[model samples]
Target: MINTFKKDDAQALKGIAIIMMIFHHCFSSTELYEKYTISFFPFKENIIVNIAVICKICVALFAFISGYGLIISYEKKKATASRWALSRYIKTFSGFWIIYILLAFVNIIFRSRFLKVYFGHGIWIGIASVFLDFAGFAKLFGTDTLLVTWWYMSAAVVYILLVPLLYKELKDKTWIILIFSMFFLRVILSHTDAGSFTGSNSIYAFIPVFISGSIFATTLFFSGGY
Candidate 1:
């Protein structure tokens, strides 16, 4: 009883997610989006909002895909955790740091007040602030004005760091525990002031969805779908 999953199907789903994300961004702004809200389009606002909501799922899809891909790779390669971490860190951070350096240069040339406004300290403090922003701690501290969208990188890194621990300790029950813990944390946080802290972009919000992908891959393998 060999169960087969099509790579093409997965790729197609990713393509759909990408399209949804693009549509979400396109409809996010008023000036450019007004063209869709004109006379002929009766339920334009509703449709746009629905699209925006649906597009939020794309983030989960991305995290799932990442987890699935990494788990599958780990299964195939049987790589050591340290090796994997080093490789992943180099692969992930190299491009980001390169871009960050370029942006820093641009900021310096333009004599941008961004650092002073955000950090409000001397050059050493400004450098520390930049590092914090790059590591995604600035967002937690409410100073993530620089590269605000890069919070995903920090969350991904945290997940990557957790992978070795999860793989070692919860090799069998990863899915169940991850799903349960995520919901439990969500419920707990919702009752407290931390509820506002666990928005869609945060690491805590995405961990369950990401680990679900690993579970899916594991199930597929056991079910002879690999």
Candidate 2:
């Protein structure tokens, strides 16, 4: 018998993750988040805070889904790693590069007057910064300057590149290692200055989650359970 995977549930999860992300962002700016002091009769302020915290899990969910989906695709297509990575790179960065180019032109034409305010740099610097970010060197050195969210894309790219090397060796025990390593890293980082900058926005911070998802995909496929 041939085993085929149905993606309806994955699609539903993606939709839910997107909604949660939007809610998380919206609530982040509200007084409930600011004060962390809002409460009802039976619930405490920590409930509200916890809800906001849970909502932020959408970022991890997205990364997990990306890793899961890519593994599934790779299995189904039986594509070479280089070809797969190249295709993924183009698909991911083509649109991003277009937008980046447009933004660069706008910044240059405006003499870097607008983006400079937020990025604290001129057009030339902005272009260079994005290149550094895309290469994943900026985040490694704690010098990222593109945007807070761009970390996701950078991390995803790094994960994709590393997948070819790590998947076969680590796929079976991903969950165990991911959980332990991430927890240990969290504990270590919590007491360090670099922790403040890493947050949930760096490749190192999300690699475990991504690998977990990839392992899940591999398991589901090999077990014919998906």
Candidate 3:
């Protein structure tokens, strides 16, 4: 048969990991784990979860690349680390906010008649969220931003503070620092008890991904960010 698949190790690993992930998700745990000893059931002893978690570990592969990429990006472009970091922050946040605002504007302008008639409830709720984000008083008002992804802006701000630390004397120890930072943050954030809807987990979920990403970065074994 003609070659139909990517031959790269990294590519192969990613595909296999994803298949393993899907396999664990699709099959009942007892059937897969009791027999194949592989599935993702979300417990330490669960063979399926183990298999799935292994595949989920791909992010570590990108940790090193992120460190290296950031350094290269700052240096080659002749931009100060501060400027580079700020630019990235603005780009990420403003991009998301802009989209939210634009959509909300259209929705509101149309909401009285056509928008409500045409668009569904979820979309209208989204417009409301955007209006809340712009207000900047959402928390006090017991509201939230128009889009859930806006929370990432807050997270990105945290990264901005950490990056210069990464850019300075701490650069070479990127992997180690990333691990520790993630662990500490995971511990602290876990206490907040955020919900599943946010995809922002407590320590139980996040530390694993960060550690996995850090491992992949330092080892140069895989290439994924999160």
lDDT of each structure?
Answer: 0.66, 0.64, 0.46
Candidate 1 minimal-lDDT segment of 10 residues: 192-201
lDDT of 1 by residue, 1-226 (tens): 5555445656776898788777666664456567564542666676676666567677677777766666655565556788888787777688888887787778767977566545676777766777777655665555544666677777777767767765653466656776687788778757655454323556556666677776776674423333
Among the numbered candidates, top TM-score falls to: 1
> Per-residue alpha-carbon lDDT of model 2 for 31-147, expressed as tens digits?
635646544458665565467657877877887777777766665646788988888777867887777567667866867643554356566766666667655446655554545
Q: Give the Cα error of residue 134 in candidate 3, in Å.
A: 5.6
Q: What does candidate 2 score on TM?
A: 0.67
How does model 2 fare in lDDT? 0.64
- What residue runs in model 3 are displaced by over 4 Å at the alpha carbon? 1-77, 112-143, 194-219, 222-226
Better of 2 and 3 by lDDT: 2
In model 1, where do residues sit more than 4 Å from their true spots?
Answer: 1-12, 29-43, 77-79, 101-119, 135-145, 173-175, 192-199, 221-226
Which tens-of-lDDT digit does each residue in 10-103 have in candidate 3?
Answer: 3555566557546544442454446564433455455544554454333333222333344334434457777877787666466666775677
| CA shift of 15, model 3, Å | 13
* Best by the lDDT measure: 1
- List the lowest-lDDT window of 10 residues for candidate 3: 195-204
